[model samples]
Every structure is written in structure tokens, then in C-alpha cells.
Target: MKSKILLNLSLFALLISSLGTSLHAQTYGKNGMVVSDHHLSSEVGVSILKKGGNAIDAAVATALSLAVTHPEAGNIGGGGFIVFMKADGDVTTFDFREKAPLAASPTMFLDENGEIRDNSNHKGLLSVGVPGTVAGLYQAHQKYGKLPWGELVQPAIDQAKNGFPMSFGLYRAALQVSKRDSSYDILQNFFRGPDGEVVAPGELWKQPALAQTLEAIRDQGRDGFYKGAVAEEIERYMKANGGIITQEDLAKYEAVERKPVKTTFKDFEIFSMPPPSSGGVALIEIMNLMEEADISKIEFNSTAYVHLVAEAMRRAFADRAEFLGDPDFNPEMPIDHLISKDFAKSRFENLDLTQASKSDSSKFGQLYGGDHTTHFSVIDKDGNAISLTYTLENSYGAGMGSDKLGFIFNNEMGDFNPVPGITTSTGQIGSDPNLVAPEKRMLSSMTPTIVAKDHKPYLVIGSPGGRTIINTVFQTVLNVLAYDMRIDRAIEAMKIHHQWLPDRILYERNLLSPDTRDALEAMGHTLIPTTNIGVLMGITYDARLRAYVGAADSASEDGAAKGY
Candidate 1:
């Protein structure tokens, strides 16, 4: 077994090097049976695949392992959503989003001046939501995993216990870590170094508290994290820092199970996490509208093609802001009604190819709904695939550290409305339905998704950015499905993004044609060139070949998608 695993790992490493050698563009990939957000992380999954574990086993292991290896972005302390598709065509949705604290009210973030305060909602205790990461992981494993839970979790434990060398990705991402709107007191102690500066990257960092916490979870199951000493530490940290989280809040948190939004696009059946996430709904709306238009005949990346899709995105985003939310709280999310062919046509017909619509026109017009989201997708060799997205609302999450736990708590509450606001639901001034409330999950923009072609799953793609998540994921998918690019070619392909707000189409500098930008501008669409489009992690599969093709974006200087 050791020899076989070592051989597979070596073969995988060789594959990555060969693939990377051709790219001065800073891209990454390895052709294999497995793929992940980071090449090294992908190698971890490949090792598990070699050791007789399926993708779920390897994915669960790698997902947890990312905490130690990819600590700059996510960890066990953060919460997210997971959508699993089994080889047998079974699918499950796990909503492990952070729930609001019991003490939270609609007006929690309102100050004496009756205005929303960033610090009040983004840091300290009020920002920490009831975490569901542990529960979510367990739920995924319990249903689809083959490896023993403890064994699967051990990789993260070992990495946390015995620190891993920091990679360039961490070193660079460290530069962008945001402090709380107002620095947290504990945060001062949390990230400070021997010289009283924020700890720099390439430093050998280990979260002993996080290691201990993971160990306890290993020994005690989900209870160890959510209902035990770990929860106590989180609550205590909140109080000590003037935050509002409490024990009851932690105890009441539950990872939700929602129906995966099902849609038919091209030759495939698609399943995605539904609202409180507008990603799925908006994606469907975009698809429904685009499918009615013959885009391929126009040309890939042509002025007209970009114009049509960008316009579709605009309209869909507008509808997103006006109608989408946590379905349980908002009775009129209009998900089904909106995505329905007739309804989509009404909205779609309102679009103009000759002129870009105003920001006031799209569903996701104000869709900066949440920025705390990130994603990872995994496929079991058995043909089961999972799309998972998690976040802490922003960089380093609330910037308040339970350093003893070796992880930052989230400011996901900032995702909520600050005041009792008007909404069609409740039809009165109250918690905007998304306002912080005990056990209520915050909204998100993380859009981790997989597409099937010809009744077979063909692609797994997702991105990490606030509103950019939608456009990044959308454009990448089109590159493969519409353009038929290989996995490496498809993912390394440049990104293009447009949001309803700002009325600007943010172009990844230098990647697109000057004509494309000019075309958009001519249509009255505002275009802004950006330094980095956004980092993307995607795996494109070839069903006939019965193999996996994957790539990570180099566009952001993030080494994450490079597979070892």
C-alpha cells in the first residue's frame, strides 16, 4: 500500500510539473483522478485515492486539512455549504452556514446615531455566528464517506499539530488580511509577533489551540466542537471582547438541509444549493435566459457574445437583489416563480442587446450580498461529486481571534441588514429577514457548482470573491461548455465579471481584447480593468475518457489551484 501510494503521489507530482512547465502565465494543474483548490491539497486527495479511499473520504480529509495548509483563507472554525452528487445520481445539500446569536436582534448593529456601524456588525462578539462547519463535515461523511471519520480528520490534525511550511499563496494572502473595521482587543494579541507586528507569511505558524480543538473533535465527534469546551471558548472570547455570542446560540445551531435547486442546462442536469444563496437561483435565471439565445453562432468572446451574457447577468443580478433570500424567512423568494420559463422570459425579454441596462434593472443589482464565501469541489472515483463553499464574511473573519483555538471567528452577521427594514415578507419593518437572529444563517455569495453534459457530470467549478463569484464561475463554465477548452486551457483562461451595482463590467486586465471592452462601453456598460480578476479553482471532466482534468487560476498570483 505504501509503495503504491508513493508511486501515485510521484506520478501526480510529475504530471503537475509537466503541465506547469509550459505556463509562464502562472497557472497550475495535474491530470489525475482527483483535483482540489490547491495542487498540494489535490495531491493529498490523490494519496487518499491511492490508499483505497473514495473522493468523499479524500475530500473530507482535504477540506479539513485546508485549515492548516490554506489557513489564510479558511479553517475548521468557519462555516459553509456543501452539495454532494453521488455516482448513483443522488444529491444532498448541507447548509452549515453560521447562525446568528440568540441575543441578536434586527437592530443589533444600529448605533446611537441609528446608522449601521461596521465595527458593531463586523467584529467582537456580535459578529460571531453559531458555526456549523463541524456538523456539516460530519453530515457529509456520515452519508457519503468511506473512510473512518477519525482517520479522515487525522490529516488536518497532523498538519495543525506539526506545522506545514507556508506556501507563497499564504505569504501573499497574508498581505491582504483585513483587520476588523475597528481592531478587536483580542485581535491585537492574536496576530501580533515578537516585535508587535502582524505575523508575516513564511513564518512557521501552528495553531496549538486549533490543533487541540481538532483533537477534541476527533475524540468526541461533533459534540466536541459545537456543544462542548470549544463552544465555551468561543462564547467566552465573544464576551471578553464585547461581542454577543453565547452558549445557547452555539447549542441551538443546526446545519440545514435544503433541496438542491435542479435545472436543465444544455445536455446536463444541474443541482445547486438554493437560496439564502442567490448563486443557484441567479445562475438558473441566467441560464434560462441565455439558453433562449443562440450565443455559439455569434462567436466565443466576441463583442456580441460578451454583450448578451453580460446583459443576462445584469438582469439576473437585478432580480436576485429584489427577490432572493433565506426561503424560510422570506416567503416570496420567487425562486421557482422567477426561474419558471414564462417568468424568466418576461424578465429576459426586458433585456436589450443594443444597450446595457441600468444597475437598477438586474436581479443581483445589489448582490454584494456576501463576501465571506469560498469553494471546493470533489468527486469520488465512484462518480459521486460534492461542491462545497465556506466563508467567514471577509478576510480573517471578524479579525477577532480565539487564538487558543488557532482560528479566527467570523463576522458573518455583517451579511445581515442593520435595521428593521421593509421586505415583501412580513410586509413590515423588521429584521430584513436576514438581520442577525438567534440560529438564523447569514446570506452568502459563494457559488460552488458542477455541470453535467449529456446526462453525465462534466465540470466542477467555483470561485472565491464577493459578487465576483457569479461572473467568475459563469465565464469559466462557458469557456468549457460553450468553447470546449481542455481543463487546463479552460481554467487558465482569463476571467470577466459584471455586477448589477456600480454599473461597471470589471475586466481582468490584458486578458480580453480591446474590442471587447470597447463593445461593452459602446453599449453604455461601464468597464473597469482590475489587477487580478479573482482566483478560481475548477476541475473539468471528460466523460468518455473517464478521467479528470483540472486547473487553478494564476490570474491572482494565488498558487492554490496548482495541483501537486
Candidate 2:
């Protein structure tokens, strides 16, 4: 009887484990490409790849489909960063980060008392930044795309015309809305039907407005979004709501090319967005510091290894706060002083094996994001790879929706400095250089990277966790090169981070050992255990087979690792 009971108990446990796995295994298509995060968006990309499109074509398709499917984050109303590498070792960066309107004054958000209005005059017209995504994607496709422009955009239009089944991620984001001012009637209509209950996952969610906007773009191309009537509607909406966005701002909007920040680790040369993107340059600095350590020799997840890496992160972040800024505007960005070999060495001078550093000096308190974002990486048979990250600055940005555009607007302007007296004519604001200006771009921590060995592309990776994005990319690369873990295993194994804020070392449990934890505690380091850092995805080339290797975050039951 006792033996039978034990057997039954074991069987019950096995059944439970299997059920959990099935619950989270995100859907994928038959061969070709894989989609994770939101099942439908991934499928949109996979559909294009299966249709004989290259990564560039698929990206445009996936991105536009996301507009109809995952409007909360996958957006047309927002903008982002893209990094691409061609087979010949040529690299480029596209900066469509939203721009302030021409009428945007440095003091636009200031009240009579001189304090910045909450969210910088949050809501109505003042909430949006000039959108760059349509233009940004258009530029990449024009240069590198193989499929017909209209062909790539068709999937998005169809999905929008019909609709897509929503998922938990979308519904959960809607149920937990914040800082949302539904001042406009169309905006209030987004989160629910007339019943006022939350929309259910897998329910068909359609945005006819989004379909119309994409249709206009499909008919006229990039001009439809930037210089045409669609652009006019956006401007009209803004100007009516006290927004300073003008026809001139819409006309003047252009996606300029910024330099890509790059470095090398072991066999691979890593490249990412430069300057204004604090994410990439900071990644280089952390890599420079971590290069001094032998990561693999130590026990995996041993406290000593964790402590060293976390300390390097703290130091690098301190420098990021003090030295980095947007180059075009500030013009004084100390690139040499920030990622310089000498500067990185100078940051390591204190080199304590023990204590966490205060972000107080860094002047950035906990940047617990009040936002939502997404990332996707693509590799074609031709050795072309792209890692792109885009956002509305926060989920359901400014909590305002565009009635005409069939999308929500970005409140990226809040990312700017809010002080009335303090100005950014210099672009240097102690540590917060990402602050706002008229037609100015905000600083973002979105790091999109590609790694190469001997001038040949090897791996392309990127993530979307705001400040955590830098550390996540750093550790993933370390796992692949120094730790020698397969790319998938490296991303899945575990993660820990220290953003130089409270000096508290944050990490996940079970992956790091008790012995390592005690050692760090002995050194006066306060450790934080956290899980679900966010999604990390990429495709790696298997040189021997000339095939592909890919991975996706599996925190959700609905994630997949698909490729051909």
C-alpha cells in the first residue's frame, strides 16, 4: 500500500510539471521562422519568412502586424532603434527615436511656479513625439529588402482589416493601466467594449483605425505617415490638445544615421547603437571592465563571480550617468572619457571585492519602468542580421490613444528634464542627458547588437528592459564566449544585475550557489533575488553547417524557438 501511494504521488507531480510546460510553450509555425512574446506577432514574421522573404522583409511585416495585434506595445505610433550588419562587414544604425515637435519649447511643460507638469503636460496633444518608425523601417527595407514593399506590408493590413486573437500579455497590460488620462473619447474606447469589462485573451482584437493608417502608407509609402494626410491628422490631434506639433515639425522629421558603438570580446567583435543610446556605449564599458576577469574558471553562479560582474556593472553605470548624452544636441559628449580604455580603467580603481555602490552619485533612483516595449532579431541566409527595439516610451504611451491614427501616442517627452530653471542647451545634465527639448530626441537604453568573429557575423542579440537591457546583453554575450554555453542555454540559465542605484546586488536564486551568496554577504553586499528579467532573443550562424541557431525567452507559456 505504501509503495503504491508513493508511485501515485510521483505520477501526480509529473503530470503537474507536464501541464505547466504545455501551458507556456508559445506557438510556432511549421519550419521557416519562430515568433515568441506574443504568439500572433511572431507568426506574422514567420509567415513572411516562409513566404520567401528575408529578415528585412519579415521585420517590416512583423512590426506592422504588431500594430494591429499588440497595440499596447508593438506600435506604429512610436519609434525605435535598429542595428544591421551585411555580409561584407559593413554596419549601420537607424535612429527613428521619436522627435519633439517644432513648436516644442524647452519650457513647454513648465507651470507658473516653474515645476514641470506631471508627465510634462501629460495627455491630449502634448503627449506625442514625432513618429519615426514608418520612415525608419522604410529606409532599411529600401536599402536591404528583397521582397516587394507592398508584399511585405500586406500581412499587417490583412490582420488589421480582419483582426487578431489577443493574448495574456496584451490583456494584462490593459487591466493594469497607469498614468492614463483618457481625455479623448476614442482613447477611452481602446481598453474595453461598451460593457466596461476587461477584454479577454484570444478574443479577436481589431483596430480599424490602424488598418486605415497602414492602408494610406501602403498606398503612398513613407510619405503617408510623415508628410501626407495621416501626418496631418496626427498634427491636428496634437495642436487641438495644446500640443505644439506643427506641419513644419512633421515635414522636417528625418531619421539621421548615428555611429554604432562597438567592442571585442574573445573571438567576436560586438557592435551597438552609439552616443545618444546610453545602452550600447555603457555595454562597451562593462565589457571592458569584465574582460579583466576569467569568468568560466570560477564555479557557475558562485558568489564571487556574481559579485565581480555585478560590481563592474555598478561602476560602468556610474560612468554612464556622469558622462553620456545625445551627440547631435549636446555636441560635448565625452566619448573618449566615457568608453575610453583609460576611463574604464579609472572607474575600476576602487575595486572592492565586496560592497554595492550607491546610485545617489549616479543621480538615478530606481528606474522601475512605468512602460512597455518589445525586441526582435533576424538573420537571413545571406548572413545579414538585424537587432531592433522599439517603444512608445511606456505601455499605452501617455495613456492617450489617437482616434484618427488607430493607435496610442508616445509620452517619450517625459523622459526629458522637468526642471524649468535647468536648461539642456549644453545636452549635459549631470547624469540625466536623456532629458527633452524642442525637436530633440530622448536618450534610451535600448541596446541592439551584432557580434562578429574575424570580420564574419556570428551572433545578433538584443533585449527590452530599459536599464536592465545593458546588463542582460552583457551577461548573454559572456555566456556564449567566456562561459562557452550554447546561446540558448546562456540566455535561459539565469541572470542578475546591479544598475549602480541603491548598491543592492540583484540576481536570481537556484542558479547562484549558497556559498557565493555567503561570500558576498560577508563583504557587506546586499543582494536582491528577482526573476523574469525580460525577453532575450537572437539567431546565430552555424558556420560549419551554414545553418542557423536561435533562442527565445520562455518565461511565458506562449514562447517558441523556431527556425529552419
Candidate 3:
């Protein structure tokens, strides 16, 4: 362990210095590509492809590497979903989303007065669900990987062991952690030195403990994380903290294979994550609503076009609030009826082009999700494409890390409705469908999507933003297919989000001209200005050119898209 640690440090110092100097904006690429939020992670995917691994193998490598390099959100200590398409046209979804422990109750986060409890739901170990990333990656590899699982995981192990230079984004996240959860475990255990100073950009940061953990997983598969020493560490951490996770929860955790939600928009057939993730249903619904409106005549991002898209977003998110949840927990949800053309037409007709509809006014024709997620898109030469999105929910999730193990835990429990009846502070009605239940998977806004035309992949896209994920993805698709924007332009374009109850349009400050914002306001739209909502990454396949156009969001300076 000691020798490996020292060797890792030396190698990391040499490698990061070389790579760090080359850090700059990456644009479109073809042949084979991996587009991710971090350059190192993207390179890891590219290396896998060069080694003869397929898109699935490259995606797993990128995901693991992100967990080490982009620790604020990317995670092995949390869970997420993977949407995959094989060259033969087979499509599937793997949901390794975290689950509520058996010991949990719907009202666990509610106080004696039946009010929602603060901090406990999202700031401690109780918020950490049974993580499924390891299992999810293993399951996907078992079915589609061209390389051995150990090989796919090694790059991340080396990254964590050898350390990497801190990027500005990660440095900012660390500073935020210091401000909000300064007393949190991460500060004391890993992110900070004995002097209590956070690591800054250009500094070498290593995770010897995380490296050891990754090695264990590489050797023992799922059991390495869920059933043995790692599990004991988790249990030990929870017992010492105020968490409720148990050895049983970790030992019994399983990643399930679910059907990808499939829909058609114009010339493309879109496949995305199913329930447990509200993304697919909502994305389809938004697309359907847009299809009903003749917005193609309007300029993209013009006042009129933005208004139509925002209204569609409002309607879809309203449905998301009322109907979506864990299928196992809510068996009566009208999954088919919600995504049907007839339902979408009715919702679309309810919208008035001249005015906005109150979120409360949308009748529950019934559908839908939130998360601070990370997404990566990979397209290999064999035509296999994987769009995977995962998260640790919130930057430095739960603001806590294990002293023994060296990764932060997710605050996904915050995704559930703390109070099942009355509406809470966020404006949406109190959520019942997504209320906590023992062993129930939490609702998610992660939409790892693939769009195909003529049975060939046209675009692969997804993003990371808490509630904005669905809309960021929704608008990006429209920007490309409808507005005919290039893949890079589509991702880099300004974005907007509306999650129903707030009854307000949140948009990127720079994207919408002041006149457009004024025009929308005149139309009775409540506008809130902000920076970019989501950090999107994607790759568009050009069959005619037989190449891939890998694109990363311009808003994310650390993002990269590499090809060879």
C-alpha cells in the first residue's frame, strides 16, 4: 500500500503537469468519441476505445474516472442510470439508483408536529442511500463490455492513487464545502490537510483510501463494495454518525435492468431512463407538446420560441410533480397514458401562445423528477453508444465523506418529499407519489438519452442540474433537431428551466436578450435570471460523414470532448 501510494504520487505529478498545460476548450470530433465534464475522465474513455473497448466499456471507465477526478458530484458512493444502444439496435436501461433503507419510513424526516425536518433529510448519513454504482457498472459490463471489468476500473484507481491537479471547478466546489459544511467529514478526513486548508487549483490531490477501495472493487466485483470490508466501513460510519444504513442494506443492494422509455419525435426514436427517473416521460411529453406547436417558423431563442418552450416545460413538470415515482411503490401510475400522443395533445392545447398557464391550473392528465447529476456520452466505431448520468446529489453530497473510505455520500434522500401532505417551501404541492418508502428507489431527473433516425443514432445527449436536467436535455434536443443547430451549438446554447409550482422561468442571463426577457415579461411570464442551469455534454453521429461530433457545454470550462 505504501509503495503504491508513493509511486502514484510521482506518476500523477508528472502526468497532470503535462495534461494540465494542454487544458483548453475542446470542440467537435469523430471516428470515436467520449464527451464528459472533465478532461481526464474523457481521456480515460478515449484510452479505453483505443484499447479495443466498446462504448459501454469506455462509458464505465469515464464514469469511474469522474468519481475520482470530479468528486464533488461524480460518485461511486451514490447511484444513477445508464442508457445503452447496441449496434444491432437493441436498447436497454440499467438503474443502479440508490434506494431507501428498509429501516426508513415515509415520515422519518417529519417532526412530531408533522413538519419537515431540516438538515437531517439532506445533510447527514441518513441522506445517503444504498449506493449502486459499482453494481450498475458491473451489470452493464457483464452484458456489453469488450474489456475485462478490472481493466475498465484501473484508470480510475490510478487517477485516485496518483492524484491529479485540482481544476478550477473542483477548487470552487471545495471552497463551497468549506463555507457550508465546514464541520463536515470531508474537511476533516480528506479534502483538507492537517492545517485545515482546502487544496487549490494546480495542487496535487490524491486519495489513497479511495484507491484502496477501488482496488478492492476491481478484485472482488460488487461484493468488494457492498458485502465486505467496504460495507463494514459504511456501517461503521453510519453507526457513529446519525445515519440509519445497515450491513443488510448494503449486502442486499442490487442494480435492476429496466426497459428504456421509448418515444418518437419527428424523424427520431428517442430512448431514455424509465421510472425511478422522471426524465424519460417528461422529456417525451415536452417533445410531444413542442411538436403540436408550429415553432419552427420562429427564430430559435427568440422571444416567441423561448416562451413556447418554457410553457411546454411548465406543463411537463406539473405532470412530473403529481404522478411519477418508484413503479414498485406506486403500481397504479398511468405510464402509457401519460406518454401517449392523445395526452400530450390535450396538454398542448391547454397552452395559450399569448399567455402562460399557472402551474396549479394544469389538470392532472398525469405523468413525471430532481438531481445534481453528471452525464457522459460515448460513441464507439462499432455503432454502440452509451449516454450515462449519475450523481452524488448536490456538490460534495451531504457534505460528508467516510474517514476510512475516501468518498462523499449522496444527499438523495432530499429528493423525496419530506412531508407527504401539505406543500413545502419549494412551491410544488407536497409529493405523495415520491414520498419515502422502505427500499423504494427515489425519483430522479436524470435523462441519459439517445435519439436515432433511420435506425441510426442521430444524437446522444444528457446534462447535470438539479431540477433543470429535464429541460436542459429537452431544449438541447429541440435546439439540434428542430432548430437545426450544430451539436456543439446545441449544447452551448443558453438554457431555461421551469418546474411547475414556482410559476417562473429561470433562464441563463446572457442567452436571452434584455428585449426578449422584457417581451416575455409583458406576456405575463415571471422571469428569473441566472447563469447556465445545466452542464450538458453530447455527441452527434453523422452517418454521411461516418464520424462523430463530440460536444461539451461551453459554460463548463472543464468539459472536454475527445476523439481519434
By TM-score, the best candidate is 3
lDDT of 2 by residue, 446-483 (tens): 88888888776677787767668888888888777777
- Lowest summed-lDDT stretch of 10 residues in model 2? 421-430
Which 10-residue window of candidate 3 scores lowest in summed lDDT? 361-370
CA shift of 210, model 2, Å = 0.7
Off by more than 4 A, model 3: 1-30, 179-182, 193-197, 361-371
Q: Compared with the true structure, what per-residue lDDT tens digits does model 3 show for residues 1-564?
A: 999888668666744643432433445555589988888899999999999999999999999999998877788988999999888888999999999998999889878888767757777777878888999999999987889999999999999987787766777777766666454766554666546678766666788889999999999988889988999998888898878999999988889999988888777898988899999999998888877886677788888888899889888877787898888889988888878889988987778989877655333322223346789999898888999999988876777867678888888987877666656335634567888888998888899999988777789999988778988998889888888888877877888888776678998887789999999999989999987788889888766777888877766657788898
Estimate the Cα RMSD of every predicted model relative to the unseen true structure: 5.5, 7.1, 3.6
Candidate 3 has an lDDT of 0.82
Q: Residue 552's C-alpha lDDT in candidate 1?
A: 59
Candidate 3, residue 529: the lDDT equals: 91
TM-score of each: 0.87, 0.86, 0.93
Evaluated against the true structure, the overall lDDT of model 2 is 0.69
True lDDT of residue 487, candidate 3: 84
TM-score between candidate 1 and the true structure: 0.87
